[model samples]
Target: MYKAACLVLALFAVALAVPSTYDTEHVWKAGNLSYVVPDNAVLGGFDPYGFNTYVGRVIYANSILPARVVVETGVAYFNTETLSSKLLVYDILVAERNVNYVWVRSFDGFYEKGAVAVGTTNKNERVFCCRAKTDGGVLIGTLLLSQKLCIIKHETLALRKFDKYEVLVAQAKGNGTLY
Candidate 1:
């Protein structure tokens, strides 16, 4: 009888200790330029280091907001098969508040790069999103786990500054497959 009473109390205690909040649905991914278009994603084709030439864009439902992204993958080692790689860059989407930050990642992310050259970019990085005279600013962020056969770097953007120049960390994704 006493053990039964204790078990009931333990159950009641657990019920009270548990916080009432929904944490399961908040998991999200770091916005990749890949998310820009639903069906128009350009697979792969471009110079590994060419800046604007490898870029892409997506016009969202808002109609007024134009989104742009880019992906690049190649071997800089220019070495033999063992040392070759796939480079990538593109528009990284982030959920933002208002227009100031077209996107800001308010939730937590299980960020995993589909791939990277030197391995994972989980290393913290300084991301600078800038522009000329229009709505412009910079961002401070980091790169995380990159695991995929094809290592690629993708960057997404929607800038007010047309002629401004910015430098970002060059990351790559590649295939470790042997054919």
Candidate 2:
């Protein structure tokens, strides 16, 4: 009886030591997962200004200041001629502080860390995600950072300010390269 009890305790300890998929630390580390923002929804699917259009690859719009573009790398901007033909793919980075929130990275390693603010430059603080549910009983992808959506500031993308904007929820697509 004593040996059995000891074995049981040992097994329990081992199980406790094993990391869970939802473990905060485990999510913080980058994994073999990638996602694409095929399109976005706004105002309960009353998408105007082509917010529901395809998001394309990252480009340095300004040649004079390359760093500026790098700083604003995470979100997609709209230029029908420039961004229409391509799609933007991002890698998932779970937030260290809150596993629920996530950060996205561009193919060139630019993170969508909110609206490129002046003071909130810390990477950890820029975690964003879509709300699980909304008033319309829809899984709307309102990509929020610090509870605010950043657009228009950099011509990244345009949507009504008060309305929630949706993002394609990132799922585990296996270790794949983001195009």
Which of the numbered candidates is closest to the native, going by highest TM-score?
A: 2
What stretches of model 2 exceed 4 Å from their correct place?
Answer: 1-52, 56-123, 127-142, 150-159, 172-179
Error of 1 at 74 (Å): 14
Question: How well does model 2 score by local distance difference test?
Answer: 0.26
> Any residue pairs clashing in model 2, and if so which?
74-112, 77-156, 141-166, 141-167
Q: How close is candidate 2 to the true structure, as a TM-score?
A: 0.22
Give the root-mean-square deviation of each candidate in angstroms: 18.2, 17.7
Cα lDDT tens digits, model 2, 1-179, are: 99999999999987655331221322222212143321221122212232321212222222100011111233332222122111132223332222222223322213343322111111223222222222223222223244354221223342322233433223333442221
> How many clashes in candidate 2?
4
lDDT, each prediction:
0.24, 0.26
lDDT per residue (tens digit) for residues 1-179 in model 1? 99999999999987655332211211112234343332322222233234222122121111111112333221111111022222232232322222111121221222222211111111222112211112132221122122111112223333111222221211222332211
Candidate 2's displacement at residue 60, Å, is 8.5
Candidate 1 stretches with Cα past 4 Å from truth are 1-68, 71-91, 102-127, 131-179
Query: What lDDT score is found at residue 48 in candidate 1?
Result: 25
